[model samples]
Target: MFRNVEIALASLYVTTTGVLIAGIYYVHQILGVEQWGIIAFLSLIMTLVVGGILAKIAITPLREHFHHLERFSKETLHELNLPINTITANVQMLRKSHTDEKSLKRLERIEIAAEMLKERYNELDYMIKKQSEREKIEHFDLREVIEERLVFLRSLYPSVTWDVMIASYVVNCDRIGLGKVIDNLIENGVKYSPKNPIITITLQDNTVSIKDQGIGMDEITLMHIYDRYYQSDSTMAGYGIGLNLVKRYCDRYGIALHISSRINEGTCVKLEFKKKGIVDG
Candidate 1:
């Protein structure tokens, strides 16, 4: 709405100025006097006053509406987090207690549901953080971070087998942003793969590659993979924001990304980070 208003006002200003200039020149020619200068100044002043009034009128409701939405989103997210955290914590405690196999399986399912909600919440949290916070740069070991994420993912998808060959390498990056990139890549590999899938991750010479034996894509589907809300398989569970966000983070950090896939075979994604001048321990 605000963008529309800005464009409209800009067009109005351009059109109005052209007409006023033409009118002033013609009036000056007709009257042959200095009074036309005063007329032109008054006209400009009136136009500015009217434009300012219109802008204020158009913007007030839009401003209020956004404020309301922001407030609602914040409050609702807070409420959602409280229950999710409580359920997750309680479920973990239950896992340590004595329980039958059937009950344990049920609890495991509940935990998976909670974790899935947490992933959705994380996506929302990622977006909110992108808007409100500056990226934090820190030196860290990429191998350690990948290992940590893999631990979490393994619990989520126990049926999938992982082959990791990442070497320790220091990198300067935003931890949260990079974590999201790794999480989304691994999550996609796990989610898209068939039962008992094999996903391989290798890090070498500042390049990290994740390969999965899954239902691969055609060239047409792969072309639009980076597009937001563009999913090759609509029936799969996702908002299609994961790959788009991964691309966004990679671009922001000067990382090079590549993808290779063959239909019914698998998909391989690679990210190469920019090299730092020196490796610091």
Candidate 2:
């Protein structure tokens, strides 16, 4: 589609230039050198007018395409919220009415899944609102967010050993975006680690560190870790955007991000939040 648009624009430009040149030639032939200056000025004005029109024509479809995509995203997110909300409400009702242990456990899993889905929905909603400069920034407990993400991730990776030492730290930022950053870091730790991986999470003094006993990256791989879609191990199953997302959120929120890794040892990621974004309880 983009290629076609480019070709069309290029063709229109060439055609317009040709017509301008031909018109100049015809005017120069019919009139004489005395009128050359006036004709040249007219041609320049005509070229500017034609170029503006052509530019508008070329941009119209692209503008419409982007608008269509934005509408689709908003509509899809709205539709998705309905079903997720339904599942959450039903699960809560079932939990209250059913007293059996097995049913309650199943309901708990469904609730967790629904919460995960809701988090994803919020992430998407954040991105959209962020583009429109409408994302909400509020004070939230950083430790609570981290613990919530750990709960969801632990459910998914039950075999992995988790060691968490977190202190109460409140931060003012886009909560969903920050939550996504935490989720990506922890998920990557779990994904890259060996079976029964030991993941350690520590939070203190407005800084958080996540260390994983996984097949770590070399110096070269570490350099490109934040490059979108650049994976250290292609054999590993991932799109390689996790670190990229982490880096982006940190940069946007004035958070300091650092990663250290060795080939055979493991990887450790640290994030230091900005002082202004932190609030003391």
Candidate 3:
């Protein structure tokens, strides 16, 4: 700390001395008392070069400081994932084995929240690490992937209705990442929605959207929907980082992401692709 202060003070002194010397030299030249400004120019330029180098050197530590903070968050979430997975699994087992209907229902809600938290942990890990930028540009069938997960998601809810428009659509993307985006969007719809709510998904051209008639979020939460590290206090447990990573992934691939919502009405997430992707007819 003291060292930085000393360096800063020295830089200030150098700046002041250079400015004073140049001003005096200019005055001397104007009064015909001096014929040489060569030394003054060189000194001024030297001061600039040295100050720039020193300032850059100071920024290195600040960069490392932020890196350390992100790494610490990753480590913390990694530890949290273990207990969360265990708790969710045990809740499932208990639901099947135990006969208490009310308790079992409560456990189911806890399990869902736990699983959501686990997914958020996964997102944090990917976002903090140096992820590959070339992963989402490959060509593949997106509708097939959606169909593959459809049965599982349907069984999990057994109430909310989903209307998928595309029977078989192909797109350019990293299958794993895009699959997660779809899963999270579906999960969000199911989590916040009332029982038997209607969830609609449409894929046309190069765009896909998941719209849910759930208790939608307000304007404030919608604005911070993609915040890196956020938490919601409305009986839902999430690290609030999933959509942020999805937005990041899409943006890197030149995809446009749009979200809209009205309180007590519904929320819509629209993803528009810009690559060699085709939607099912």
Candidate 4:
């Protein structure tokens, strides 16, 4: 589609320039030097008007396509809320009534699944709001958010070992965005690791680090880690958008992000908050 648009645009430019050149030559020969300036001005104005119309016409379809996608995303997210809420509410009621170990375990799994769905919904909503520039920044406890995300992730990946040593540090930023960033880093560590992955997380002095014993990337892979949809290992089951989103959020919030890895050893990611928005508690 983009190639077609490029072709159309190229053709439009060539045709417009050819016409302008021919018009100028004719005016120069027939109208003499005195009137040439006025003719040239008129020709330039005509070219601009024609070019603007052609460009708008060529771009209208692409614009409408994105508009439809955005609208569809909003509507789908709105529809998802009802089912997620229903599942969560019903699970809560069941948990209150059931006391048997087997039944409670089943209920817990259901509750976890529902919570995961809710998290996904929140992630999608956050992305939409972020693209639209509607996300608001506010002060929130960094430790609290990381702990909350870890709780959910631990439930999902029970085999993975978590070593956390987080301090109470408050920072002003998009709370949901920050949560997404943490979730992505931790999840990546889990996803890329072996049978029993060990993830180490620590926070101190407004800086946080997440280190993982995973199949680490080489230097070339690390260089392209932030590229959207680029995956180092094709066997991995992910669309490769995690690190890209993390990079964007960090850059936007003035957070310093550093990632280092050694192949077969592991990967470590660090985020340092700017002093202006950080408050040690």
Instruction: Tell me the TM-score of each prediction against the true structure.
Output: 0.79, 0.80, 0.60, 0.85
Question: What is the C-alpha lDDT profile of model 4 across 214-273, one tens digit per residue?
Answer: 889899999999999999989889999899999988988888999999998999999999
Q: How many angstroms is residue 257 displaced in model 1 relative to the true structure, after the best TM-score fit?
A: 0.8
What do the candidate models score in CA lDDT, each in turn?
0.81, 0.85, 0.73, 0.88
Predicted model with the maximum TM-score = 4
> What order do you get sorting by TM-score, best first?
4, 2, 1, 3
How would the candidate models be sorted by lDDT, starting from the highest?
4, 2, 1, 3
- The lowest-lDDT stretch of 10 consecutive residues in candidate 3 is 128-137
Cα RMSD (Å) per model?
A: 4.5, 3.9, 6.4, 3.4
What is the per-residue lDDT of model 1 for residues 119-190, given as tens digits with 9 covering 90 to 100? 778767766667765556778889888998887788888888889899877788777778889988988887
User: So what's the TM-score on candidate 3?
Assistant: 0.60
What is candidate 3's lDDT per residue for 161-196, written digit by digit as tens? 888897455676567677778887888887778889
Q: Return whichever of 3 and 4 wins on TM-score.
A: 4
Off by over 4 Å in 4: 1-11, 22-26, 34-41, 278-281
Angstrom error at residue 61, model 1: 2.8
**Model 2 regions more than 4 Å off:** 1-4, 19-45, 96-98, 139-141, 168-172, 275-281
* Candidate 1 C-alpha RMSD relative to the actual structure: 4.5
